[model samples]
Target: MARAATATATATASCAPRLLRAALLLLLLVAATRRAAGAPVVSELRCQCLQTVQGIHQKNIQSVKVTPAGSHCAQTEVIATLKNGQKACLNPAAPMVKKMIDRMLNKGSTN
Candidate 1:
């Protein structure tokens, strides 16, 4: 009976570390999932890409690029890189942005 008790205690002691490791792994996964789920949401405000081209532009946007939102925003986003290396986000489906995307697509197709 005493030998059986000692064996059971040792088995439980060995299992405790594995159980703790599993619990820690589960917590890390949950944290990572929560962080991924908290990704930036798409804004409702309509972006005017043309405005960046006209008038006294403060942004000085050098280039505009399309970025597809995967599991986050659902909609596509346009990122405008400024001359000073700053970036601004815009709506991809906006008038000027759409024109840019279409132009790029057409250019790629012809190549």
Candidate 2:
């Protein structure tokens, strides 16, 4: 009977660590999901100039405009005005321009 008790205790102790690890992993997953859901939606735009430069090997874009649209997590409109007099409005934030705009807007709020 003592031997059986010792075996049971050992098994219980081993199970405790596994349970704790599982709980920690579950908490981490929940936190990550919440963070991702709370993140802002960024939008992107592409114009004639962007298309033209994309074909070139080493072309630099001149001007890009990123504007925030809507109050909620909905789609945002971005306007890209290139140096070549081409304009384009796109929904879904452009990665580079969206980062820049978000940073600028966030900074403006702190002041």
Candidate 3:
């Protein structure tokens, strides 16, 4: 009985290292696959503004959100929500939009 118990313990001990090695190998393969094939392969879509208007009246604009260029987009985006519950993309380079942004920025700074 003692010999049988000893044999079982030995078997379990030997299998433990094999099981642990297999698990470690699987983890390494999964990590390597993710590193090699995951990030760039998936399409990272950015830059929401496909088209932008040159101007919109200041009073008609309910809110404006300005997003600066970053990893998501190369150009600055100005999105305005109109009082009529419609959203419009404004061209950041446009003279009228630039003036409106400047005024809003100045007003914000003063407050």
What do the candidate models score in CA lDDT, each in turn?
A: 0.69, 0.57, 0.92
Residue 77's lDDT within candidate 3 is: 95
- Model 1 Cα lDDT, one tens digit per residue, 47-90: 33332332214347687777565654455667778798877766
TM-score of 1: 0.42
* TM-score to native of every candidate shown: 0.42, 0.36, 0.59
Best by TM-score: 3
Model 2 TM-score? 0.36
lDDT accuracy of residue 108 in candidate 1:
91
Off by over 4 Å in 3: 1-45
- The runs of at least 3 residues in candidate 2 whose Cα sits more than 4 Å from the true structure, single-residue gaps closed, are 40-111
Sort all candidates by TM-score, best to worst: 3, 1, 2
Candidate 2 lDDT at 2 equals: 100
Candidate 2 local lDDT, 1-111, one digit each (tens): 999999999999999999999999999999999989876564423232222222211133344455344443244455555567656553333455556556667988999
Q: Return the clash pairs for model 2, or none.
A: 42-93, 43-92, 43-93, 43-94, 44-92, 44-93, 44-94
